[model samples]
Target: MSIVVNLQSKAKPETTTKLISFIEEKLPAVRGFSGCMQVSICLNRDSGDLLFYEKWSSKEAHEKYLLNIQNNGVMAQLMSYLSDPPTVNYYESLDI
Candidate 1:
């Protein structure tokens, strides 16, 4: 089944702009990644928290993408922008 993933991160206030710019530059890669169906991001200005919503073909697909980025240093770069480690959760759509 396809899965939806949510990643929440609190950006360092001073690095928020850099974080946004980084994502803007990298988003095309993310959107084009295998199994990725859609991606959306929202920010809570008050808390400096970013919410990333994504849809993927499967949980394994998402995990695979994570591994790819981890090896290529994208994960490390992302961590540098955050005040706290990001939290991720996944869910499957419910049939109506």
Candidate 2:
């Protein structure tokens, strides 16, 4: 099953643009990884929220990426823009 990691960021409005740009720049490196399926960034029209969708070939692939991120302290750098811990949801593709 494909693993989908949905991240919702509660960053302030003024910082949203730079926050998105930061992630966009970093995403290319992640998308180049072996198991990455797809990556998308979206803004919620209603709430002005930011969302990051990451699809991976398998749970192990995602887990490995997470582990590497922690070990390298890459995840720590993301803390500056967060209003709270990012809300992460794991899901399986039911149709696509």
Query: Which candidate wins on TM-score?
Result: 1
Question: Highest lDDT: which candidate?
Answer: 1
TM-score, candidate 1, is 0.97
Query: lDDT for each of the candidates?
Result: 0.94, 0.79
User: Residue-pair clashes per candidate, as listed?
Assistant: 0, 0
lDDT of 2 by residue, 1-96 (tens): 787889887766666677778787788878987799998888764565778899999878888887888888778876666666778888987774
**What is the TM-score of each predicted model, taking all chains together?**
0.97, 0.81
Residue 67's lDDT within candidate 1 is: 99
Over 1-96, each residue of candidate 1 has an lDDT whose tens digit, in order, gives 788999998999998889999999999999999999999999887899899999999999999999999999999999999999999999996666
How big is the positional error of residue 86 in model 2, measured in Å on the Cα after superposition? 0.9
Which parts of model 1 are misplaced by more than 4 Å?
none
What is the clash tally of candidate 1?
0
